[model samples]
Target: MTFGGLPTRWEPPGASRGVALVAPGRSYPPTAPLLDFTRVALLQHGFTVQQIWWDSLTRGEEEPEAWVRRHVAAAHAREDADRVLVVGKSLGTLAAPYAAERGLDAIWLTPLLTDPSVAEAVGANAGRQLLVGGLADALWDASVARELEEGGCQVLAVPDADHGMGTRGAVRTAEIHLEVARAVEAFLAGAAAGAGA
Candidate 1:
């Protein structure tokens, strides 16, 4: 499906618990390992997934936050789901404020903690939020993560993992992936229960 001329990949389960809108990083497409695993996890959890694709080169003159908000909001409106969840990575974390504004649950992978706006937005979310970041990532700030956790957001900080959440060894990297995936599942389970409540 396409929303506002932006390409999207939609997968709707037979009976959806809700909608999961995936926003990828500037260089990361939905097909990347982190996002692909997230898509599968959401599908397994009975969400209708909508993954948006975009080229940063073509973003034109709009501000990063404004562009992200416009496209994300457009896609959210197009989905028209009663319940919504947002999963964003890296640059896509720019949409944090929008998701927070709508009180939607969200999972942020490798969020841009270096950006004050992004960190602030993530901290402001009233709904359930899961934030995963690598300790080795230059953009990941431990202090900020601690503060966000204190504010009620769930956080998973992987040791020896870089910006791509990859460790020095393949085996360890795979283990990290599994760990992140399990965290996602647990977080989604909690979100599902909260929604049912």
Candidate 2:
């Protein structure tokens, strides 16, 4: 996916105090049919999701930073989204921190790298971050996870799961989404309350 491009699909929720940006992994289409499940889950949880422009065949063309910023801006403009949250899968996870830098809370699911360098580059400093992954995910290591946590971010590790959290089997499907929604909701609630106080 290139920067300055548009999301292939945009799903709005019944009501939202914030916006959630969704980024798909490499080689995945923005309109991938399977994403219907994810979209449904987010909507069910009362989130307004700004979709990604995923292009699987457009190999190595992803400009992560620019794409993330553009979508966030567009979503805010369109919905008057007061709070922004990021949800990224695989390569998308790499972009989540970028959103966080611009005042959004983030959730990175199965990022491909455990590189703290990446975290530094994105300015994921001392707060406003969340990372979720399975123990089987080679992209992220314990050290990297620890680095994020030490930086004041929240982290969740799934047992026996892989990069996508789908490699394990059916049992993880609802569990992963549920965990993601719950975490994000809690973060949003806390952030909102903090701001109001």
Candidate 3:
């Protein structure tokens, strides 16, 4: 499948409640553990998942914000759903501004909190937003995450986890993954309930 004219991997469930757009990082593709598991979680939550494949060789040269705006806008134009959720990670977190501007629900994995604009966007979003990041990630700022949480965003700050949310041992890494997955599921459930209300 193709989304916003970019190659994509589409997974549509039998009865979808909405659409979930999965945007990957600069080096991390959708097939990565974090993103792939996110796709599975969204599917389990009855969302049609569209995992966009970025052409880093070409589109990566464009400004981060601009690239996200163009592709996400195209996705919105093509998708016909009452609800839309954006699941982004790292470079993909640039979509924060666009998602905020459009009032879309989002789950940001390892978001680039180092970018003031991205942090501001997350804080400004009135719609449901889930931010998951690790304390050990250079781009993850604990203070910023706390501020966003105070502003009503759901946050999962993992201690000792890296940019990939991986901890020291294999067992710990798996535990972190489970924790993240549970957070995503709970967040989506709340969003769904809020929408129905």
Candidate 4:
């Protein structure tokens, strides 16, 4: 997706601890539940958030890595946030390297493990990052996920869930979402604390 549009900025009063930049997946709205939940979590942990604007490019069009890099890096630099946390999904996993180079932590949802560069960037990032993916996802790699875990990444591998972390039935989907929320909350909390430390 092309990084175009106005960012949704949220600054909680007295927020002094850190900041978060949310990068969303291709074709997904920036107001997705995942981003909403993360915004609240970050606010509760005293972090300001900027939900980056996104508009998907044509399928045959190349993913705009340079555009993403310029925007994310510029935003991060402008904020001068000490304890930065990046949250992304699917194609947004492209930001891993930018975050990594800045020594920042991140949470990657439905990461593009099919891309060696994405996997390597996520795996090599210094902090103990969090990854969420389902076995049914075409882009997911269980071996690579395991390897990432072994190398300090935390993975939440869901059974029978697809690329969007969705299953067949409504009940199962809700269950998976609940589990994801719990994991994300814990991960963000821990990372914020660690950054404070």
Candidate 5:
């Protein structure tokens, strides 16, 4: 699918209760297991998944948040969606403010917690959110994650995992991917329930 002329991949399920938008990292493709896991979890939770594919955004020559915001706005307009859940990876975490400002639920994997703007967004967001980061990842900040949790954001911290949440090899990587998937499913379920509150 295409949103605002940007290449996008959509996993739309019948009778979906909501929409899920995934913004992947500069290096990670939408098909990455972490993202794929998100897709599966959203589908299982009755949410459609709309993923923005790489184009110029993959170059990293320019900042991604602007492009992210634009694509999100376009996707929302195109889908005419009322309930949206934004999910992001490393560089994609820059979209936290857009999600926050819009009051949309979100899942941030390996977020760039070191950035004050990102921290501030998660801190001030009023909508349901899940934050996952790793201690091994330089971009991950334990204090910030704890602060977001204190502010009502659900958080998951993986030990010995890097920015991609990889434990080292394929075996361990797949294992962590499973863990993240299960966590996301639970998070989505909780967020869905919270929307009714």
Candidate 6:
């Protein structure tokens, strides 16, 4: 799909309660194995995945916040989408919440939250959102994680791994898949249930 002059890939349509928007990292394509693995994981947990590639942002070329608004509008067009969830890895995380600000829920993976000025551009309450990352991720620090939590997001720290959580290749493990699936299921269900409260 083309949104705001950018290209995005949508997963083959499947059974899902909502639409999931995944923004991939700079070093890899949307179809990279790690992203593919994560996409499948989200599918196994009943999410239909759509990916937006913003690799240019890392090179100081693209404006992620602007891209985010376009994709969020795209997700909103999906039938029966009461809520859209924006999920991102690394640089994409900086943009994901920008969409969330427009009323979609967002999930950040090994995110690096930049200055408040940028965060404010995303939305007033944008920083107060869910974030997930591995404990061993070098891209993030504890203080940043705490700031996100303080802003009101529920942060889930994956143990013993880096940004993509490949410690011993957990991506291929049935146990790890189950764990991630459960966490996502619970998080979405809870978020849905709490939408008005």
Off by over 4 Å in 1: 2-8
What lDDT does each candidate get? 0.88, 0.61, 0.88, 0.79, 0.82, 0.60
Query: What tens digits encode model 3's per-residue C-alpha lDDT throughout 74-131?
Result: 8777898888899999988999999999898999999999999999999988888999
In candidate 2, what are the lDDT values of residues 65-118, reduced to their tens digit?
565555545655665666666667776666654665565666666765555545
Q: Which prediction has the highest TM-score against the true structure?
A: 1
How much is the lDDT of residue 105 in candidate 2? 67
Badly placed stretches (over 4 Å) of model 3 are: 2-12
Error of 4 at 26 (Å): 0.8
Q: Please tell me which model should have the higher lDDT, number 3 or number 4.
A: 3
Instruction: Please give the range of 10 consecutive residues that has the lowest summed lDDT in model 1.
Output: 3-12
Each model's backbone clash number: 0, 1, 0, 0, 0, 0
User: In candidate 5, which residue pairs clash?
Assistant: none
Off by over 4 Å in 4: 1-7, 58-63
lDDT by residue for model 1 over 49-163, one digit each (tens)?
Answer: 8997878888899899888888789889888678899999888889999998888899999999889998898888888999999999999998999999999999999978998
Tens digit of lDDT per residue, candidate 6, span 2-110? 6566545444355565667777665655666545666666565556677775546444554665565455455556536654677766666666546655655676666
- For candidate 4, lDDT tens digit of each residue in 1-197? 23355448888778567788888888765677666776777777778887776565643355566666666777677787667888888877788888777667898888888888888888779866889989999999999999999998989999888987888898988788777888888987787667669
TM-score: which is higher, 1 or 6? Answer: 1
Show the lowest summed lDDT stretch of 10 residues, model 4: 54-63
lDDT for each residue of candidate 5 in 1-197, tens digit (9 for 90 to 100) = 67567545555567878788888887886778888878877887888788876565355655667877776677677675678888888877888999888888889999999999889998888888889878899999999899889889888898878888987699988887787887898897787676678
Worst 10 residues of 3 by lDDT: 3-12
Q: Report the number of backbone clashes for model 1.
A: 0
Candidate 1 collision pairs:
none
Reference-based TM-score of each model: 0.93, 0.69, 0.92, 0.89, 0.89, 0.63
